[model samples]
Target: MFDKVLVANRGEIAVRVIRACKDLGIGTVAVYSEADKHGGHVRFADEAYNVGPARAADSYLDHEAIIETAKQAGADAIHPGYGFLAENAEFAGKVESTDGVVWVGPSSDAMEQLGEKTKARAVMSDADVPIVPGTDPIEEPDAVRTFAEEHGYPIAIKAEGGGGGRGMKIVREESEIEEQLESAKREGEAYFDNDSVYLERYIENPRHIEVQVIADEHGNVRHLGERDCSLQRRHQKVIEEGPSSALSEGLREEILEAARRGVDAAGYYNAGTVEFLVEEDPDRAPGERLDDDTDFYFLEVNTRIQVEHTVTEEITGIDIVKWQLRVAAGDEIGFAQSDVAFDGHAMEFRINAENAAEDFAPATGGTLETYDPPGGIGVRMDDALRQGDDLVTDYDSMVAKLIVHGSDREECLARSRRALAEYDIEGIPTIIPFHRLMLTDGPFVDGTHHTKYLDEDLDTERIEEAQAKWGTDGEAAASGGDGTTTQELTIEVDGKRFDVKLENPGLPTNGAGQQAAGGGGAGGGTTSASGGSGGDQAATLEGQQVTAEMQGTILEVNVEEGDEVASGDVICVLEAMKMENDVVAPSGGTVTHVAVSSGDSVDMGDTLLALE
Candidate 1:
């Protein structure tokens, strides 16, 4: 194994790689942008170096800066952890040619072959792997229409270089095809720098299943089974698990074989994922299915460690990062297909700092407090953040991954529930509530979920109902429980805006919306904080006076003496934990007093602007 390795990424994944390297007695070097100088991963590394600014383009994606850092630290190799430059073929080549510094990933030539979706599909086709039916490059809208007719309606127009659902549009009607196709092309060019596009028959109600493949220099290729990444929103995976619940034993074998073949054909080595869209239509004939009743078809290949690789690692005792390092050092295959044995089931929930009720909109805030991850036999929490850390909008929204393992799928689900309940966070919005709901959900529990699980199986009505109840009133806030309020309220003080939220209430409430009917009490009312009719109380704050919801510096005071304001009116703005929240008026009433001003810092329960 290499003596030293540099992790060319940030966030939880960087921390994950560092831990793996340390376990193998390898000194680890960490490269961080200015934003991550004080991050957890930086402090965890044996040595750390500053790369550039927070913006990914100026730092993580800056290949030259990363290479120089590795060279300066005298790193023997660099591990591009998943995102930034993980899949950049040129970056891999640059590292490989630089004397002793190796790239701990697949060969550059392999990446080049699989990087281009159109080319990879052709390669998979030639290898006898079943691929989705679509044209190589459909430049015109008429071609899309023609393909749609042949493949039937609801086909997808995808950019040649698109992955992660970017630069792709689903067209369910002929009239919507032309505009969406052009839009996809534009997004493709803007994001991936490739305007080229293709077409595929959309497999409705398909599960996002992927097989993990590892190949060594000796041409020994093996698979680490499949991960069911069906839970997603906007094409991004939210939850993932190893040993898919949908695949039969025979189908699993077939998909695993296909992934091995694809990797072999591309000369792939190191860590990579072969993604497929598994159709859920049980009524389809075997002839209609892609591979003799196997409904799964090739989607694309991810030529790097996946965000959900922890689940795979949990199920299989083998450490993927260690294997990547060994392979880069010219080692032979560490384990054969038969040598690898999977035990138990594992699941991972991606805890993003985003609100699930509002289309999963990403939110930003600084950590007011932090808690150590819960420890148990089968629970693992991976995070690269710490107390006083800033959650910026400059990168991906995911803050941590909560992974749970157990003897079987049912046990894993139960453990996931216990883990989510124990995991605690504050000062920002998270999807923990959604995950809690999913753990007990019928489709999820029954293993009938699909890629559109978030869209199809989710109880949006209930989620909305809960958001409406808690979003406005202090008593109904999402994090308000145990007589401790942990909800952030946006208020306008003077003319500026402020953002704030609750933190570490001990016994935190996972965002499960509101409690079931007859849950709260006879005295409690689920009234909208914003002006609305229906709840028993005109406003939930009738007995409880409205106050500053979180710790923040007051930006402005919008109310004056005897100034009557309606509910939801911009009352004041507090800049709390680095976010601007607008404090709205709880009811139509005259402003009794204004207690704070711009630049004045205050804690939760401090009266900034009060309505009488």
Candidate 2:
């Protein structure tokens, strides 16, 4: 076993990796950015280091800083927990080449071959795995039109290095081909540093199913079964469950075998997920299951531990993360494929810090005044926040995950309702109300909900009613600290990180308080804090001003100082929480002044431009 391992991520996932390392009797090291200096993961690890600033590009995604920190901490291996540089093949190659250090994932060559969508599709096709009809890397808008002509309307343009709906766009007609194609390419470049994209025949109503597979260096592979993630919003999964209620026994077996076959053909190792899009029969009854002849197509391969892996763990009684460590240490699989048997049904609910009624807008700020999670049999809470910890709005909004297990799907749903009701979080907005509403929803409870159900079919008024009944009111102003204070400083001695604290007798309270959390409304209020890297506020500007709705970095400035634009025209693109959003003109006008550039970071309410 390795002596020590460094976790190159943040939030609950980082803490999860550290705990797994500790279970194997290995020392753990943590690296955090300036915004995460007081993160729970840093406090749990044996040693921690400050990598860079709050911006992810300068901190969590900085390859050189993370590698150097691992070396200085005397760690022998590095584990990337999901996001950031988890599936980055170049970073894996760098770690592989570093002496005396091991990368706890697949080989760089295998990652490059499977991480790209087109290449993986080729590999799966060659392995006799059913794949959706799609094109290779496309360059122009004409290519998209041609594909749509053959595949019919509603084509999906996906980025080469994209997953979890980051760099994917949907075009329903020829008129939207050019704009959607450009937006997809821009998001690809901003998120994955790859401008390449491909086309696929979009399945209108399909269940998002995925199989969890793990392999070792000795050619031993195992599949833990399948998970259904059809409940989604904006193409991102909201709730995931294992042992799908919509699949027959024979159909489930086929999917499991296909997942194993694809991974084995790609020569992949460690933990990975093989996702598929299974077509749904709308004419079938509510509780009907898909037969063996049902159509299913390979979607993509997630090259790391998934956010919903806990569901599989609960049902199969397997320690997937520990297996990741053991496989990296050159251990062979001791159990056969037949030994993997699921015990019960499990569901994982992502406790994101967002208001679901208001289109799921991410929360700006606020402290966790009352952070209480439910406990008992068959309920697991994976989180890193304490009672008084302030919510971090710089990264993903998912602060915790609630996984419930039971003997059957009905029992699982029943337990989930109770668990969600028991979860208490104040001073910030969360989607607990939405989860509760889903438990009572007809299609979801009957296992007939598809990937587009939330975005397309569900009535918005029901969501509003749920939020009004059960949502938390986070509009109250947060109280600043008392008189006494302690300041923490990070110092380095001989390239090793050490934290220093200094006490002060009398100090004034923070007059400029933190940004209030989102309430059950359309928009969250402003912040007393100053403007970010986007320069000063636009108080002097006279025309209609465009402001940022969330904290994010500018990826592109579409308008100049005096550019003519119509109403609803995109003015700029902002990258936040690993997703791209376009800031558009509220009304038709000419740009009077621009306050931000392509790479500037902006906080909520920061002015981006002014229009007349």
Index of the highest-TM-score prediction: 2
Candidate 2 deviant stretches above 4 angstroms: 476-545, 564-569, 578-580, 586-592
lDDT measured at residue 40 in model 2 versus the true structure, 0 to 100 = 91
Q: What is the lDDT, from 0 to 100, of the residue 42 in candidate 1?
A: 88
Per-residue lDDT of candidate 1, residues 167-270 (tens digit): 78889999998878876876566556688999988888887889998889889998999999988776888889988877677788889999999889888888
Clash count (model 2, backbone only) = 0
Local accuracy of candidate 2 as per-residue lDDT tens digits, 1-612: 999999999999998999999999999999999999999999999999999998888999999999999999999999998988989999999999999999998888888988999999999999889999999999999999889778898999999988888789999989999888988888888778898999999999899999999999999999999999999988899999999999999999999999999999999999999999999988767878999999999999988999999999999999999999999999998789989988989999999998877788888887887899998888998999988998999888988999999999999999999999899887788889999999999999999999999999999999978876677435321211233334446999999999674444344324232222332222334322222222355667767678887898899998899899998888888887667888888888888889899878877788888878
Report the error of model 1 at residue 216, Å.
0.6
Q: What RMSD value applies to candidate 2?
A: 9.7
TM-score of 2: 0.89
